[model samples]
Target: MLNKNLQNTKFDIRFFILCSIFFVVTSPFASCSAPPKLKTQTLTITRFDKSTITLVAEIAKTEEEKEYGFMNRKDIPDGTGMLFVYKKDIHLSFWMKNTPLPLSIAYIDSKGIIRELYDMTPYSLAPIIGQYACRYALEVPQGWFSANNITVNSKIDLSSL
Candidate 1:
């Protein structure tokens, strides 16, 4: 009886230690899992001079996708951005909740003309609201619009989206 009890205790201790090791090895990776896959399309911004700049834009069309937009991202390459599509024109608002990258957003009207632009601070919770109803919003790395001379009334070619 004494020998059986000793063996049982040893088994339980071994099992607990193995479980602890597994949890320790896996917990960090589980929390750092890869981001969800996103669909991409090309978007072009046409200036009044007829010059155009293009970007590879990730499409955020679903409610969940929109809610998760750019959160926790460490970097966004130049000439790349996220385009948010809505079912109807709305006075949309955005915030930088958990987003680490500084970005500038353009509010595009249904006619594909940009109506407003905002430079968002990283990790800011302050709401950035569109001045008018917009059907789409494009977010790019900070200073992208200014560097490219994109501004209000600049047209976006979203035919490829």
Candidate 2:
């Protein structure tokens, strides 16, 4: 009986440890893909008409940061956005899973020129894929591009990033 009780105690401890690990791994981001706010920098957009607009950008340099994106974010103030960076120009894709904010994404070439612009619906499961090779993607509140007169071929000053 004493040996059986010892084995049962060991099993209980192991089960408790496994459950604790599971909670720790999944608890922080368990609610609606909520992610911690990332680092921010000043980014400037030079429009095709030669006018310039400056905004603050949250830099998403890591894969995890890029994946979480603005998920569960309810409010995106005007003049602020997120910048997703890559090592080289490639086909860029995005989805609005668990993201409630309607956004406009500008796919930018390695030279910092806007290649394409796409408007994304909130919580949309459809993938918004880019045909052009792009090194970066900038997401802002919907209609921000047209509102600011920033259109395709506009130069984004990546050097300031």
Candidate 2 segments exceeding 4 Å error: 1-34
Per-residue lDDT tens digits of candidate 1, residues 1-161?
Answer: 99999999999999999999999999967645556678999887899798998889999998988988998899899999999999899999999988898999999998899999999999899999888999999999999999999989999987665
Model 2 lDDT, residue 41, Cα = 90
**Which regions of candidate 1 deviate over 4 angstroms?**
1-34
| Candidate 2, residue 109: how far the Cα is off, in Å | 0.6
lDDT (0 to 1) per candidate? 0.91, 0.92
How far in Å is the alpha carbon of 8 misplaced in model 1?
20
- Ten-residue stretch with the least lDDT total in model 2: 28-37
Task: Write one digit per residue (lDDT tens) for candidate 2, span 1-161.
Answer: 99999999999999999999999999976775548669999888888778889989999999999998999887999999999999988999999988888999999998899999999999999999999989999999999999999999999899865
Candidate 1 residue 13 Cα shift, in angstroms, is 19
